[model samples]
Target: MSEQSKSPQAPDRTPRVVIAGAGMAGVQTAVALREQGWRGAITLLGDEPHQPYDRPPLSKAVLLGKADGATLDVDFPGLGIDLRLGCRATALRPADRLVETDQGPVRYDYAVLATGAAPVRLPGTEGLSGVHLLRTLDDAERLRPELAGRRRIVVVGAGWIGAEFATAAREAGCEVTVVEAADRPLAGALPPEVARYMAGWYGDAGAELRTGVAVASVAPGAVTLADGTVLPADTVVVGIGARPATAWLAGSGVALSPVDGSVLADERLHTSVPGVYAVGDCASFPSARYGTRLLVHHWDNALQGPRAVAENIARGEAEGVVYDPVPYFWSEQFGRFVQYAGYHGDADELVWRGDPAGAAWSVLWLRRADGPDAVAGAGRLVALLAVGRPRDLAQGRRLIERGALLDRERAADATVPLKAAVR
Candidate 1:
C-alpha cells in the first residue's frame, strides 16, 4: 500500500470502507465494491431505523397504502456487509480516516458520502400542526392519514415532488391546491413556453392551482398569501425544493460548492480529500459531456454514480473510469408520464416534435451546427423532454449519449422516429 492511504494498523489488516447514508447510492456502492471483487470489511450506515428502502414510492403507493414500503431487495447478511440502521455519520475526519457517528467513531481506509438531501421547508412552518414535508418514509406515513381523511391540502411548490403529491392526493379524493411563487409550474425546470402547457393539468385533474404568488404565513387551518389572500388548508404540503444534506461536512476540509453546498467531486467522483468519494444527491461532479458542473438530485444519478465510484475504488486509480453520464429521470403526474434526458443549454435550439397541447409530444434541445462551439458537440442532440411518449425518451437519450447530429426538419416530424432524424 502507498504511504498515503495506509492505516496505522499492521500491514496484514483487512482494508475497510465506510459508507454513510444507506440510500441507493450508499447501498449500491457497498454491493458494487463486492461485485468488483473487494473482499474486505464494508460498513453501511443509515440514520433511519427502517431497512434501506426506495424514496420514489413514498409519494405514490406508500401514501395511498397500495404498498407497504419500497424496501430494497439486497441481502446484506448474505453479502457479508455490516448494515447498521439508525446510525448517522456526524462528521468525517479524513486526516485520521475516522468517521464520527452517534454510535461511535469508526475508522476506515476509504469512504463514500451519499447522505442525499433534505427538503426545504417553508419558513415559519416548523412545528405547525398541519404543515408537512414529504421526503422520508415517516413523512409519508404521517401524511397517509390526512389523505385518508380527504383533507384539503395546499402544496407549497409546483416542482416535481409537489406535482406528484398533488396527483396522489387527487387520486385519494382529497382537494389539492398548489400555489407556486413563479408564474407557472416547473418554472425552474422548464422554460415558460414549455411549462405553460402544464398549468392546465392541475385544473384538469380537479385540483386548484394558484400561480405568481407567494405564501405569507402558515397557520394550523389556513395559509395566508402575500397578496392578502387567505387559503383554507386543512393539511399543508411543502415541496418547494431540497438542498444537499452536507452540513456534517463542515470543518471537514472537504471542498464543497458555495452555490449549493454539494461536495465538489472531480471527474472520477473523488472528493477533495484523498481516499474519499462523494455520490448521489450530496455531490456535484464536473461534466465534460455538458461543459459544466452538475448537481443532479434525481434517482438516475443515485443509481449511476455509485457504479463508477465502486469501479474506481475496486480498480486502481490509474484504471479509474470517468463519471460522465447523460442524465435521465421520469415522473408520473397528472396522469401524464414525464421524462427528461441530457442537460439543456441556453444557446441550444428548441424543436417541437408534436403539438404541446396534444397528449403525446416531445421537445428536443439541440445545438446548432454553425454555432461558435461547433468543435465541442455542436449540431448534436443535447437534451429532450418527452410527455406521454416513452419511445421518444428512449431514443433521444441514446442520441444524447452518442452526441448524434439531427436533421431539424425531420426531427420536427412527430411521426418520424428520432433515430431516423439522425444525420
Candidate 2:
C-alpha cells in the first residue's frame, strides 16, 4: 500500500481518525483531515462493496445512461488513508472510542459519523420485482433496464427525486404517471402556490401528475390508489423522503432528536459524546444564521460540513471553526432548473420576483420586521428560490450570508438584479 509520512515537526505518535460511512460526507472528512495537515491514521469504512461515488447523478445522468457512475476522485492508499469497503458499522462504543464493524472493531482518537440518509421505501413493496428506490449506484443500475424498455412507469411522491425520475422515464419514451399524497407537488418543501405552479410541469413534460392521491397498495403490474382506482404500471418508483441514518447509534450516548431521530450536533458539529462528531444527513447542526437547527440532506452540506469537523479535530477546540452555512441545493426536473439557497420560515415575508406562472421567475423570502422602518434595516434576505435563474441564486447566497437588508419594492421588481435590491 502507498503511504505518506507524517510531518517532521509533529510528534512520533499521531492520532488516528476513524470515519464511519464511505459516502460523500465520510470520504470528504478523511480528505479534509489530510488537507488540513492532520497526519493521522485515517480509516474510512463503507458498507457498500462498490467504490465511493456521488449520489445526485443516480436519478438523472446515471439513470438515463448519459454518463457512468460519478465516483469520488481520491487516491485512497496514496493518501495513507485506509479505505475498508463492504464493512458495515454495526454499533458505536463511545466510551472505548471504537466502532464495531462487520469485519471487526476499529479504534480511533476521533470518530466522525456520516452515514447519510436512506430512501424511504413503500410498505409491502419489498421483494417486488419492478418496485425500486433510487439511492445508490446499484439501485440505479437495477432500474435503468426498466427505463430502457417501453413500460408504464408510476412514480410515487412528487418530490425532487420522483420528478427527476419521471423526467428521465418520459425522456426514454415511457408512459409516466406521478402520484402524490399532497394537493400539490413538493408539498413538504414548497408552498402550496409554488407547488401548484410546479404541478403543471408534469403535463408539459407529457407525464400525468396526480396530486392528493395516496397509494393504497403496490403489487405486480399496478398501483392501487386510495380512491379505489387502479393505475396500470409496469414499474413503481418510491421517493417519499429520507430520515437520518442513526439507528446504529441508538445506545451510544449520543443525543438524537426524538422527532426525526437526527443526531443533535452542536454548532461545531460535535456530538454529545466527546471526540465524536456527526455531519451530513445523519446530523442536525444548530445554525445561528437561521436561528434554528438545520438538518440538511443535500450535496452541499456533505461537501462543506467535513471541513469544520476536520478543523476541530486537528486544531483543537480553541481554534475550532463554526459551521453555519447557508443551505443550498438544486434540482433539474420538467425542463426547469430549480435552485434554492438559505433557510426559510413562516416568519419570513414572501417577495415574488417576476411571475410564478411564467417560464422564469424567482422568490425572495425576507425575514419579517416589526414596523415600516424595519423594512430598511431589519428585513433581511433570509432565503431565495430561483427557477431558471442561476444568477439570482448566486448573488442571493452571498447577500443572505451578509444578512443584507432589502427594499421590498425593488426586490419584487423582476427587472432589478437581486444584489441591487439591497438598501
Candidate 2: give the clashing pairs.
none
lDDT of 2 by residue, 1-423 (tens): 111223436533457898999999999999999988898799998999999999999999899899789898999999999999999888999887788887777777899999999888899888898899989999999888899996899999999999999999999999999999999888888887678889999999999999997999998999999999999999999999999999999899999999888999999999999999899989999999888889998999999999999999999878999999999999999889999999888767888899999989999899866765555434689999999999999999999999999888988998999899888
Model 1 C-alpha lDDT per residue in residues 84-203, reported as the tens digit of each score: 999999999988898888877778889999999999989888898989999999999999999999999999999999999999999999999999999999988898889988899999
Clashing residue pairs in all predictions, respectively, total: 0, 0
Give TM per candidate: 0.96, 0.95
lDDT of each: 0.92, 0.90
Candidate 1 TM-score versus the reference: 0.96
